[model samples]
Target: MDIPQVISKQAAETGEMGQEYLATGKQVSMRRWEQAASEFGETHCREYETVGMLISGILELDLDGQTATLGAGDSWLVPEGAPHRYRIVEAVVAIEATSPPARFNNRDEPTSGEA
Candidate 1:
């Protein structure tokens, strides 16, 4: 996929799920999730690894049938190809990074950084 070249933080690409801030290098993709507690997500088995930090709210991750609940200041690592699914237990704000970029990411063009 053609990851658009970016310089600094700008308006990121988002979908029905959440917003993502993509890097120009195409080596990483980051996103923030702020969903209502009523929201539920399907199972996911990603091709890339992920490292994430829980900034606020609540989240429940089901990794191959093992469930774990996370809150503010908590962090986690999801290995590539791990089957996992999660739900927003409370309105959440989490920051996550994906290696080799995420296939779900979308971008129109790069703009000036948010810095």
Candidate 2:
């Protein structure tokens, strides 16, 4: 039987994109970006789909050539294999979840480009 797990903010594992792995399941993984730097910007494609919510601060996302600004309470999704990039307009606190467990097979890492 699978057991429920508890992870505190202090215990979260730091990963790429200045994110912390909050939890990782068989089919999905969750992460948190706490006060991410404004210089945080990267262009790349991922193998897994990503859905995220802006908990606080501003973010600008460019997905498949469409750009949008996200504020607190705003959420966005990037389909798997789609080209995307993001710029942090302000220090941000956000939460994101990825399907197929992005941490699996190092899918969480960018496929190309630099931050």
Candidate 3:
């Protein structure tokens, strides 16, 4: 079995995915987006599947034309290769977990063009 690890908020790896902080393991990864307000109109189709929760503030998620408004205590999922986009209705602090390690081999990077 693997050893236990602890990562504090200040110790998270930062500077990817627009100032988000990340804690990554072999099979999965978690990222914290604090007060993020950029990329509101850009749509992206990621290579990894993600499950996320809004810790605070408001967000609008558009998944392949269907839209949902997310507030504190809300959670969401985006399947791999699913085209999606986010609009920040308010400054957002959120946490997301990705399978297959989204940061591995630059999987977290945005695709070449809009989805």
lDDT of each: 0.70, 0.85, 0.83
The estimated TM-scores of all candidates read 0.73, 0.89, 0.88
Better of 2 and 3 by TM-score: 2
Query: Of the candidates numbered 1 and 3, which has the greater lDDT value?
Result: 3
What would the per-residue lDDT of candidate 1 be over residues 1-115, giving only the tens digit for each residue? 7656653445666654455555535577776666678544566677678889999998988887888999999998888778777778988888888886764443212212211
Lowest-sum lDDT 10-residue window in model 3: 14-23
Arrange candidates by TM-score, descending.
Answer: 2, 3, 1
- Per-residue lDDT of candidate 2, residues 1-115 (tens digit): 7687688989988886568988888888999987754653677888899999999999899998899999999999999988888888888899999998887797776577744
Candidate 3 lDDT, 48-115, residue by residue in tens: 89999999999999998899999999999999988888898899988999998887797866695564
Best-fitting candidate, scored by lDDT: 2
For residue 100, model 2's alpha carbon misses the true position, in angstroms, by: 0.8
Q: Which of 1 and 2 is the better model by TM-score?
A: 2
Q: Which candidate leads in TM-score?
A: 2
